[model samples]
Each structure stands twice: as C-alpha cells, then as structure tokens.
Target: MPKLNYETVRYGDDPQVGASNAKQIFLLEELLRAIALQGYSFTTVTPLTHQRFLLGFDGLAKNTRDIFGWNLPFKATILPPYIFKIMTEADLLFNGGDCFRSKIRISSLGEDLFLHSHFPTNDSHAVFFGPDTYRFARFVRHSLRLFQLQSGFADRSIPIRVLDVGCGSGAGGIAVIRSLPIHQLYELNLNDLNFAALEYARVCANVAGIPVNVLHGDFFNIKNSQFDLIVSNPPYLNDPAARLYRDGGSLLGLELSLRIARHALGLLAPGGRFLLYTGMAITSDDNNPLLSELLPYLANDKFQWTYDEIDPDIFGEELKQSNYQNANRIAAVGLTVMRIT
Candidate 1:
C-alpha cells in the first residue's frame, strides 16, 4: 500500500502541493487542539451504522461534529478559519464539488481525540476506530487496575514496559498509559504493519501528550523483547475485501487473533500481562473455536488468565457474506493473560 503522505498528498487530481513534513504534523495537531477547545466529541460507530446515518442525509455540515465526527462534507464557512486553513495546509481535506470533506475523522475516547481514516473506511490500509476500540480501551483500563491490585506491580520500583500490537491510531497504548498513575514510570511501544496507521498513531499520541516508540513492522519482528503489559484490538472481521484494518484472515476471522495471541504470549515478561480484545465467530452450535484453541496455552501452570464475551453479537450485517456462512454470530471477546513465572 502507498504510504499516506501528510507532506504531499494527491487528492484526486487537485494539485501537487502540501505543507512541509514538520509543518503538516504540527498543523494537524493544532487542528485537533482547536477542535478540543470547542469541546467537540464524536464516538465513531460501526460502518453499517455510519452508512445508515448518511443515507438520505444530503444536508451540509452545521457544526464541527458534523464535519469531523459525522464525516460530512461542509462549506468552508462552516469551519473556523484556523481549522479550515490547518486542514488544507496539512492535506487533510478532500474537495467535493461544492464543499470539502475531511480526509480524516477524529473520535473521542475518554478525554483524548484520535485521528483515523475517514468514514466508510474502505481503503485497504485505512486506520479504524469504532465501538470495538472503546471496548478494548475499557478492557485495558480494567485489566490494568486488576494488575495493580493483584500483582503489587504498581508499588514496585521497576519501570513498566507496555506494547500495543496492531496499534491502530495508538488508542490502546494511549489509553493504557493515560490511565496509569502519575507516579508510575512506564514506556509505551506501538507496532503496526500499516505505515498509515503508524502515522495516525503518532499524531494521536502527540495530541494526547503521550511519548511512544513506534515500531513500523509486525509484532513478530521485535525479537528478544518482552513487555510488562501488552494490549491489542486487532481487526477481527472476515471482510471479503480483506482490508488491512478489517479482515482477520481465515477461520471465521479468528485466525489472525490466534496468531497474535501465540506471538504476544511469548513476549510477556515474567509477571507481565497480555490483554486482547477481538471478535470470535460462533458457529450455530454455540461453540467458540478461537477460545477452544487458546485453552491449551492458557492452561499452563505458570500463567493465569481470564476470558469474557464482551458482547454476544456484533456486526450482524456481516452474516450475509459467504466468509461468515458458518458463523451464527460474531461475539466480541476479551482475554487477559498474565505470566506468573
């Protein structure tokens, strides 16, 4: 996939111009800050829900939420002058006939805003944020609390090391680090195969005031490294398009999740924890093959873990696809595994 270039983006056949790299990144952050000052907030929903919202809605944007959150095209006058200028200079706007559409969407998670690919994220490498991101962040926060309470790691002097695999928009790492107590020293590592995602993650982390180390490769590429807390919210849908941000490979979309689990589990330091949030394709017989496959690993005496179905059914609209023909439902699930040895 062609890396999304903030410095020189070609929006259709408009112009061959863009802001300088430093200026573009700074301007993008400024744009987000400006929106934050306005108390703007938008929670991204499933793609189906988003599509439904735009259906029969041909109205122009009335506010920042419409343009940034709802991903609607708007007349230039609708946006504050600075926001408009920043977006244009940063190559973040798509000129649509009579109005402009933001090439990026900002979603609010807790008090922080994250930049992701625009709505109807059909692009293969589109960075995505939705209900699953929210759930994953909550799961991380909750697991962190439990880790602190049960393991006494918070009171120790050892600096905590954290990693977020397939870190789309760096939401998982950002949320985990933000939820950590001020006194706790920690390092955050974010890895993703999508360069576009890494760029977006970098911007989001900068906006959140969180320092992060971005690894621009698959998690398996990081060798001889272990983390105290590793969290991931990987793509878990059996998208027919096989988009990088959607498809989870074969086996009802659980194959990638299983692969990540196997790899991340090995990178857990002693007393470290691995937190995962993904969808499980449940067959008509009500069996979760993903969990069943993971049991042998979690059954080890040296590790302790917990699993939960966060939601019984999600993405019901996907059932019509042949990829999920054997799936009766897609269940949102969470797994937290801690190494005791």
Candidate 2:
C-alpha cells in the first residue's frame, strides 16, 4: 500500500487545518440534516452485495438514498437545489464528463448518521462502514446494558473512562457513549491510524453531540493509565491491496485482533470491561486461532472472559483468496473480558 501522508496532529489544533476541517464538518452535518429532514435512511451492505444491487438498477440515481447511500452517479438536476448547493459548497460533488458523483457516503445507524468514503473504497485511507460496523455497535450497546446490571455499577458517580482502539468512524465509542444513562458521566477517547478516518470520526462525534478526544496513530498509540471500558472492531481480512481498513496482518488476519486484545488487557482498570468484535478464521479442523492465543492471557485470576460467535459464517466469498485457503470460513466473534481483582 502507498504510504499515507498524514500530518500527525493532536485534535487538529493548527488554526488553518482546524478552520478547513470545521467548514467541511459543518457542511457535512448540514447535508445530513437535509437528508434526515427528507426522511432518507439506508443501511450499507458489503462491497460485493452493493455491486450486485447496483447491477439491478439504472446507473443513474433516483433519490437521496440512491445518490448518497448507494453511491450512484447522478445528473446535477437529480438533487434538490439546496442539497446540490451544500454538496457544491462542501466540495463533495465530483464531476464526470456526463454525470456527477458524491465524494462520500452517509450511512444510518438508527437515527445517527456517519460520513465515510464512497463505495469501491480502493483508496489506501478509505474510511469503511458496513455490516461489521452495525454488529460492533450492537455489541457495544449490549455490553453497556449488561454492565449496568452489575453490582455497584450504578452507585459510583465518577465518570467512566472509555477508549475505542482503531476507532474508524468512531462508531464503537460513540455507540457506547450514546447508550449510557443521561446521568452517567463518561470520557470518550478514540484512536485510529488513518487521518481521513479521524476526520470523519470528529464530524460524527460533533453531529452526535458527544465530546471525544481523538488520537491519530497506529494501534496502541494512546498512552493512558487505564480505562473503565474499552472496545474495538478491527479489520480481519487479508486484502491483497493491503488497505489499512481491511488488512489484519498474518495468522489468517487474526494477528491484529490478538495484538489488540493483549494491549487492551494491560490498559483495563480494575473492574473494567473490554469488548472486542472481530472476524476469526475457523479451519476445517475446527481450530480457532484467535481464541487459542487469547485464552492464555485470560487465565489469570484477575480476569473473567467469555467468547461468543456472533456469526458462524461471514465473508464466505473470501474463501477464493489464497491467503484464506486453509480456512473453511470466517466467523464473526465477540470477546468480553472483565477485570475483577
């Protein structure tokens, strides 16, 4: 993959960059508001499914969902005048010789909207949001509900410190913050290696009215003492293109997931909980490489953990790749580890 030229900034503090980012986010939020006013809603599917769906439709867009969610090419006249003006102002409208396309896609998670890269995300820094994102959000919400039921969980008044590792689009952290009780205080921290992802995350956070501290770096970049809750949904595919959002290194793409689990354990405070949602390659022999490696780490008395298969088979199409030749299927798995010393 080509190296991403990202200016390593903390919170995008530079005046010029901050101003430009502010304008871009403002326009994106405006666009999202306009879309919601029109009651537009769409759920993003896998890239393959999206392509298959597009094949059944005319290449041109017919509605807000078609133009923005399906990422179809549309003529300038297809959009309402106000929507067109916002896209133009935001510089998100791309001109083709005969048609116009959107530079980004907005996806819906219930009432919340998130901005991400357009379809066919072939770019090295594409911010991805799809089925995995939805699963991750659900896992976070479920975990928070369960956490609230724990003894003494409702008594403490101190704010919970939460972190989301490799928080693309800040979905996991944002979902956790959103699901919390209104009286419960929280400090949300999100970190990602992709600069473009961080930008979208910031915009998503702003639109949701959730305050967040964004960290830009590779895995394990944010140096904090500990967190009351940590969550992640990392990439687990062996992409030939080596896209940061898709490649999960070696070990049948479970390497990054394992590494994240280890790092999260060390940063979890006493009584803290870590929730991970990722894909695990299950071999023909029924061996799960990820759980095997993670079991040893949770053997200590201070930790209690549970692993559940969220989906028995996902990305079945990936079997065609030589990298996954030894694997029978990719399973979506969720791991929850609670520190209880």
Candidate 3:
C-alpha cells in the first residue's frame, strides 16, 4: 500500500491531491456531526438481523433514520431536503432506483458518532462497527481503569501511548481517547492492512480531534515501537471468501488472533498491557483449545494474564459452514496480559 504523505496533508495550506480527498472526508465528518447534533443515534445490528428488520418494514424506508440507520433504501422525495443535499455533496449516498441509500453507516457511541462501511458489508475493505465494537469499548475502558489503579502508570513522565491492532473503524482506541480526561494526554497508532479501513480510521480520528499515527500493514509488520497499551478486536471467523475483515485463517479461526498476541507481546513497554477481544473455537475434543495454545506463551511470572469467556456461544450460524463443521461453537473471549517489570 502506498503511504499517505504526512507533509502534504495540511488541508488549509496545501493544494495537494490528497488534500482534496481530505477535504471530502472533513465534509463527511461535518455531516455526521450535524446529524448527531440532531439527536440521531443508532446501534448497528448483525447483518442477518438487519435484513430481518428491513423485511418487517416492507423494504421501503420512511425517513432519514430508515435510510441511514436501518441501512434501507428511501425515495429521494422522502429524504429531508437538507440532509439529502449534504449526503450528495459528501458522496455518502447511492441511488437505488428512485430511492437513495447511504454509502456509509453511522452509529453512536456515547456522545460521538462513528462512520463505517454500509450495510451488508461484503466488500474486501469493509470497515465494520457493531456489537463487538461496543464490547471492545467496554473492555478498553476496564483495562484503562485497571492500568490507572495499578502502579507505574502514575509516572507523569510516561504518557499513555497505544497501538490499536486491526483498528477496523478506529473505534476501540479513539473511544478510549475520548473517555480519558483532557489532562491525561496520549498518542495513538491505528494499524490495519485494509487501505480503505485505514482511510476511514484517519477520518474518524480526525473528527474526534485525536492525534493518531496511521500504520498501514499487517500487525506483525509493526516493529521497533513499544506502546504503553496494545489492543485488538480481531476478526475470528473462517469465511469461505477469505474476506480481509472477517476471515481468521485455517486454524478454525484462531490463526490471526494468536499471531497478533505473539507479536504484540514484544511491542508492550514495561507495565504495558495487551487486551485482545476475539472469538475462540471450541471443538468436540477440547473445550478451550485457543487458550491452551496461548497459555505457554504467557507463562512467565512477569506477565499477568487473564482469559475470560465473555460469551459462551456466538455466531452459531457459522457452524453450518464446512470450516466450522468440526467445531462445536465459537465463543466471544477476552485476553488481558500486562507486562510488569
């Protein structure tokens, strides 16, 4: 992936081509902010459930919330003229017959509104934000609270530096940044292999006024950088299409999660923490195979490791696929490891 030139990114001063793209992103952010101010709040649901809900509405969108929030299509006449104008100028709307749909989806997280790929996100570079995003936000808040409660974090010389691995929509880390007090300043890195995802992340971080260093590549490509915190909400499903955002590879979906945990350990500074929120596949023979494999890696006494099954069963629909035929079920799991020196 070609690197986005940092020097050419001064929107107000530079006439660079990238600046034009940046300007469009700014407009998109402004549009979303305005929508949020209008009390527009939505929580994204699963694609399956979203489809079912769309059916209940007779497949015709009634208002802005129906078109944008429910990811449904709406006739242009039904749209609020001003909102439609902004969507058109912001390049956020698509024509569906006489109806128009948003190119992106907006969801609310507290006071902030997050932008992500539109409904039925089947594209290779889809930026996903949904229920798991909420869970990851909770996990990050808890981890930061734990860090503050522990010793060594009190050292003012050390600022809170975080590396968000596979930051799909940059929601996990930016949410933390927004939650932290202004006095507790921090720098963050958003890492993702998907170029589109990184672009969306940059826009999200910019909208939040968060200072983010966007790293475009696989998480393992990361090196020579130690962070006070490393967090990941990695994709853990064995998709037949091997989608960049969803496929977890051939190990019954644990491949990418394990790989991230291994490399992330080296990137954690002393007293630093790693929080991995992912799904684990439990087979017929072994109940916690993923944890068993990960335990040996964190066996050292210096590391405080804890694993919790946040949800014992999720994505039961995945079991119908051949990749998960032998697997009993996929469970939502959280792995927290802190390097204490």
Candidate 4:
C-alpha cells in the first residue's frame, strides 16, 4: 500500500460534499445547544416532531434526495424513548468529561455513513462508526451496478442474498438493503462479535422492516450459511491486543479478515460474490508479502478476484498510533470483490 495523498482525492471539494459534511456538524451542535438552552425541552413532549424539525434544520431531509435520488423511503422517526434517554445521559457524561469532542459531524455518501471523530467507547478504539461503513457501502453498490450491467439485468429485478459481518449499528447492512429493490433480497444475515452491536442491529432491522437473521458470535465461528452476496466492513486496525469491536486478530490486522475470507469461500453459493472493505498495512519490506499471503487464501480455483483503491491515507500519525497502527507506515484500504464459480 502506498501513502494516500488527500490533496488528489477526487471527492474532496465537491460543493455538495462540503455542504453535506457541514450540515451534519451543524446538526450535532444545534442539538447540543438546544439541550443546553432548554434542558431537553425538545425531547420531552413531542420528540418525534422535534427530531424531524432538527433533521430539517440540518438539511438531512433535503440531503436524502442526494443520497437516494428521491425522498427517503420512510419518514424520520424519533429513536425510541428509552434510546433517547440513554443518548441524553451519554451526552451529559460526554459533555462533563473529555471523552468526546466539543464538535462532531455526520458524513454520508450513498449507503455509507459515519461520524467525523472517534468517540470513547468500551467496545472499539475510535468513537462512533468510522469511515469504513461509508466506504464499504459505496463499494458494494458499485459491485451491484457492475453485476447488473454484466448480467444484462440493468433494468430487471435481480434478487441478492447478502451477509454483513461485524455489522455495527447495522448501518452497512441497512445501506445495502436500502440501495437494492426490496423483496429482491432473498436472505440477509447480520453478524457482530459484540453483543451490543448485534442487539442494535436487530432493533434497527425490526424498525426498518428489513428481516434479518442476527448472529451474535465471532465471524470465524459461523457455519452452515451460503449466500449470493457477502459484504463486510470489518475492523482492520492493526492492534495487537484484542478489542471486541475493531481489532480483528493478532496476525497484524489480517487474521480476522483471513478467517472471514476463508469461511466466505465455503459459504458463497456457486457464482456468488463476496465484497469486503478493509485496510491492510503496507510496509517497506521487500516484495509486499501481505498481498501474496492473502492471494493464496483469498484466491481459489473457483473465484475471480479484483482489488481496488490500493491505499488511501485517512488520518495522521498520532491518531493512528492511538488506534494501534503505525502512523508513519503506509497502509492500503481496499474494495475487494471475489466471485465464486
């Protein structure tokens, strides 16, 4: 993997991109400010209406057009009251302590979405869902478009079965479900090592009316599942120590991913596709051993593989260090698609 030059990245300066990012930040700030000024008045009486108003103020409703090319399928609904209470308490705790930053923003491109900064949480190193969710969604959507084109089903219904591993907040899974035509999804499986995330995914699935089979266990331990499409936005942080949410495994950052890929090969039905979004450490060592190591495991007689976006620098050294990877060393974030024959 080579270093990513943010300056040359294509999506950086588009006006709509800038506005979308700004609006999310503004929305979070406004929410906080409103709470400070009115002591949760907005949340107390008519929380559903209040949330819609705030979403409008932040341009979220309008941005739906940019994301889906039309109105969002469902109206904005208030998070359940208990969830709201938990968020309020969490907000208070974060405000009083230095765990969370003063400002945070939401960013989304298509089905991918993320919060700007990492939040302090027990399960993962960085706070909030990282940018991986957005990146994964984009890649999967692109793959689907390619599939449609190649199969001459560009305008026809092509049902797909998808699997989401380590699905946190269920955002990545939700993104895929929302992008495709409903009822075209034959089977959707959401898996996470974290019990909390799995529970959250279940709640989200129910609320969205997207039926999913939720598995609360390690990705490496899954069995008896075959699907047409497998998608994952896995944790690839090169942390030596085990963190339930983000650290994949001990063999640098590739152990968990390797295990998942191996299992995915077994689980993919004939002519099925596996799409993954993950980061890999690219070092100065001779021959770039990582890719070769993966080739044997990721490539097989039956699958054709394509890897893109070799490397894209996302953050500075200090941030990377805290998250457990070598900040100065280059790494690659890739969209890898493998077709099983």
Candidate 5:
C-alpha cells in the first residue's frame, strides 16, 4: 500500500465511511460515557495484549469490563438487560452465531472515558487512543498552563480558538478544552479526513458538553480559518498497511510532520501557537534529518520554538522492516512553535 499523503486526502461523502455507522458509534459513546460515570475505566494496551486478553476469555467478553476493555465478543447474558438493549438498539450489538460484539471500544484517559475504533485498528479510518494519547494530552495541558501564566488572560473579551488538525479520536482538542476553567469561552475546531474520526470527535465533544466546529477535510482545508492554538499528534511511521492513522509518508516517516508544521505557520493568528507531537527516525549515521528539515522554518525571527525528545526510543519493533534498516532508533518528540508578528 502506498503511504498516505495528508494534503491529498479527499473530503465529501463515501459509502463505506457511512453516517449510519457514525450514529451507531454515537450511541455506543453515550452508553460508554454513562458507564464511565459509574467509576469504570480501562487503560488500553497494545494490539498484542488486546488479543491475548480476549483469547484468555475464550475470545468472548464474559463481563462488562472485558467487553469495554478488550474489545472481545460477548454473550447476551453478560450484560444488564437494559444496557444490552441499548447496544442492540444502536445496531452495533452484533451476533456472530454464538456471541455478540460491538463496533466500538471504550477506554479511559484519567477519569474521562472515550469511545474509539475497536482493537486491531487495521482499518483506514480507525480512531485510536493509547499511551501516546495520554502523553499528548499531558503536553497540551502543560502548554495551556504556560500560556495561562504568560498571557495572564488580562483581556477576557478576547476569544480563544483552537484547532486539532489531524485530530483522531478528538482527544487532544477535547482534553484541552476540558482542562480549561468552566468560565472560559472557547471554540474548538477539529479537522480530519476520516468521517468516522469526525463522528467520534462530535460524540466526544458532546459528552464533554464542549462546543466545537468540526471540519471534514485535510488540514486547513477551510482556507481562511485561523486559530489561536493548533495541535496534533500525527502518524509518524512508514506503516506497511498505509493505514490513515499510522503512515506518515516519506522522509523516513517525517513528511506529514513537516507539512503540518509549515502549513500551520501560515495559518496562525499572530500570537497563535502550535504543539506537534510525533515520532522521529534516527538513522545509523545518528542524523536527525527531520529536525534539520524543520529548522529553516523555525530559525526565522517570525517564530519562537522549542523541540524536545520525550522518548528517545520507541517502536523498536519497527526496526525489523527494510525501510528502517538504516535507522538506529525512533524517538517520540514534541515541537512547540509560536508565531510572532
């Protein structure tokens, strides 16, 4: 499969990325949000463990925890009748002859539960949330705190606008909004090419009661739109599947990161800022080409920037691939850029 090019993703409707499925996911998200209020939380794991946990349960979710946490099939008797009825009404409680399953998975970030695509997210429109989501959320929180202290909100009349470009599960934008004080007025714009992702994003925003303006298209497809803050945790690997959420395209999986950074610079509202969390490939020659490519844009006086490597080595498993044969390591990094007039 060819690597995904973010700039080229088409908008408009497609049959496969159906609305009915999105409605089903919304219902599922509502149900899971209720469960979340009951002190239910599941920290999702990698795909290997996701399968293994369900395998131990005979490939079926024997209880509520198993159902939400492992993405396993479940028998009708495993859940409360009302909850089962809700799932059934959503048209998602599928019966595979012997057992039933849901099309979405509910996981937690802190006490906040989220509905996302099921495990083994091999689909092109998969919306994923995991360890990286948690880290990205932290970075967002940190940035907000820094902004609050530095900017001092002296002018309450000024509107705060944010864009989560390439938002995949809406976690980044929603989490940032939720972290803000309730009295603050803000508008979050979530932009993504995947209809499924936008649907999930809407549901998440609804669950949080946060106002949002969702755009279904590539980054900045709206042209004149600008934001006070732009954030993303873009795909940063050369995934063989070319899954929309995993492949970052050429430059050793740094292409999308570079594109987003450059494009975002032009879309910021003067004092606007960008927080990008992505992984970088370190070659055998110990060169950081990704950073090198971005420096020219960041080096100018028009911007204030900082780069940090949060994880020096990640996805070590990907090294087995020929594309990564020359890579010495893969690191998760965060880049914060502020546009100054």
Candidate 6:
C-alpha cells in the first residue's frame, strides 16, 4: 500500500516494440480527416458537458477501435447536446437511430503517436469525429502522462495496478494499460448500474485484450478493494426526471457521485489517487448547496483533493433552469483529483 509511483514501474527496455498497433494509427488519421471536413472547431465550443461532450463519442470511438480498429480525433465543443440531437435525429431520419452503429479504429505510428477513425455504421458512410471521443482520448492520455510523471515508472516495476469506475466502453482502462511502462498488470474494474453498458464494456475490454472485472451493480456496493490509481467520469447531472444514463441519483446529482467518492476513498490505498470528471450544482438561490453537502463526506484526515474545470456555462440556460429545480442559472462540471493518505 505504499505510494505506487507509476514512474518507477519498469515498462520494458525495447520501447518501440509495443508502442501502438498499426490499425490504431490508421484510425486516428481517418478521425482527423473527418473532423476537418466538419468545419467545426473545438475552440469555437467553449464549454462542453461531460456527458454529451465526451461520453457519447468516447464510447463509440473505443468500441470501434476495439471491434474494428478505428481511431478518430475529436475537439471540444460547446453545443454538444445540440450536435448529438442533430446527429441522432439525422440517423433516425434516414437509417433509424438504433440501426446505425458507431465504429472507430486506431493505428499506431510508433510507441507514442497514433491514427484513428470514427464511423457511424460502415467506413464508407462514416461521418466526422465528435468531441466526446476526443475528450475521452484526451483524458486517458493525460491521465497516463500524469501517472508516468508522478510514479516515475520509466525504470522500476514491470506491471501496474489501475482501476476505472463507470468505465464506459472501458476506454480509460484500456488507455491506462496500453500507455503504462510495464506489461499492464491492470486490475480493470468497470462498474455501472446499466446491464447493457456493462455488457458492452466487457466485450470491449475482452477485445482489447485487457483483463477486466466487470461489475453491473451500483457503485455503492463496492468496498474493501484497493488500487494504485482510480479514475472515473461518473453521471453528474441533477436531472432526476431524465433516463438512468443521464441521471443516476436523487434530487441532487451528487448522491451517486458522492457514494462513488466515498467508496473510492476506501478502495484507494495509501498514497493512491482518484481522478474523476463530474459536475457541481451551483445556483444563485440558497435552496441547496451541492458541494457543501459532499464536502463533509469528502473532508477527512485521509485525503486531499483538487477540483479542476468548474464551468458555469457547462449547461445550457434551459437545462440549468430545469435541472436546478428553478433555483439558479449557474452550475459547473468539475474535473476532480483526490489523493488518499
């Protein structure tokens, strides 16, 4: 349970051997090309929702990569919900939304860079990549680099233990294992309340050759497990009326996230860290304080935390009004990192 420095993990001497597979590189190129054709830039979309901006495309991209070897590039976008609505609607217009299956592929150039593709149904009718996939990839890559820098894994241990909660399509786990310095002795745990999502995650993990422990139950049920590092992009919307995928809690969106955080605190070993992407409901009124409620549970002698990316405009005005129960006009999504003592 000592500080598991990823930097100290021995990733192997021949760095060029398992850098990236050729398929991944090709997929990346395809994805980039598709993005360029869209004429939409990530910069133009200032604030992006964690769910619409990342989860949708990320799940599609990872699934494509696992099943068909596609890698696609994605940029951040502000109106992700609109974009998704349009795309899904368009799909529904022509081929029926459910009939269209998204696919992605990634080919490796060397050990560091890669190419990828994102396709809707088949490669021929593929559209440009979306922001969600890009965000997903970016988060995974960033997490790996962070671990490598912090753990000093370039010269020590041969394998590392990693865990990902709410691992949709298991992309985060795959990214961690693939980018690590060792043989990726990953103890991948993918948990979700959705049976379909859990099943899909299992298939994706198996295809990627990454051994995983899939849990198709509530995150609150997990306990006593430990890992070197833990990461998640939990359901963070305060929409109690929405579907389970979008809303996983009571009136406050933090119920499930807080539960996961508390469980993660217990699961994380000493010196380990938990990285998560979520949102906090901040309103103009004094009806309720989202962060304040969770602070007590999160505040303990055993851990320290950092909250990244608190965007007031993360949601549209309409969504804000509806989600907050007509409380306020502002809320923020946070990328939080926590360290366990």
Which numbered prediction scores highest in TM-score against the true structure?
2
Q: Clash pairs of candidate 1?
A: none
- In candidate 2, what are the lDDT values of residues 288-338, reduced to their tens digit? 787779888899898999888898899999999888888888899999999
**What lDDT, from 0 to 1, does candidate 6 have?**
0.48
lDDT for each candidate structure: 0.83, 0.84, 0.79, 0.52, 0.77, 0.48
For candidate 3, lDDT tens digit of each residue in 143-259?
777767776764554468877889988999887786565677577878888866776777777777777777766677667777878899999998888888988987887889999
lDDT of 5 by residue, 78-101 (tens): 777777788888765667897887
Error of 1 at 38 (Å): 1.6
Best by lDDT: 2
Q: Report the candidate with higher TM-score, 4 versus 5.
A: 5
Please give, for residues 130-157, the per-residue lDDT of candidate 1 as tens digits. Answer: 9989988998888887777774566446
Clash pairs, model 4 backbone: 112-134, 118-127, 119-127
Residue ranges of candidate 4 with Cα displaced over 4 Å? 1-118, 122-128, 152-159, 298-300, 318-330
For candidate 4, give the lDDT: 0.52
**Pairs clashing within candidate 3:** none
- Overall local distance difference test of candidate 1: 0.83
> What is the descending lDDT order?
2, 1, 3, 5, 4, 6
Clashes of each: 0, 0, 0, 3, 0, 46
Candidate with the larger TM-score of 5 and 6 = 5
- TM-score, candidate 3, is 0.90
TM for every model, in the order presented, reads 0.91, 0.93, 0.90, 0.62, 0.89, 0.56
Alpha carbon lDDT at 309, candidate 5? 83
Clashing pairs in model 5?
none
lDDT of 6 by residue, 3-71 (tens): 321211111222321233223323333343433344422211212332245445554323222322332
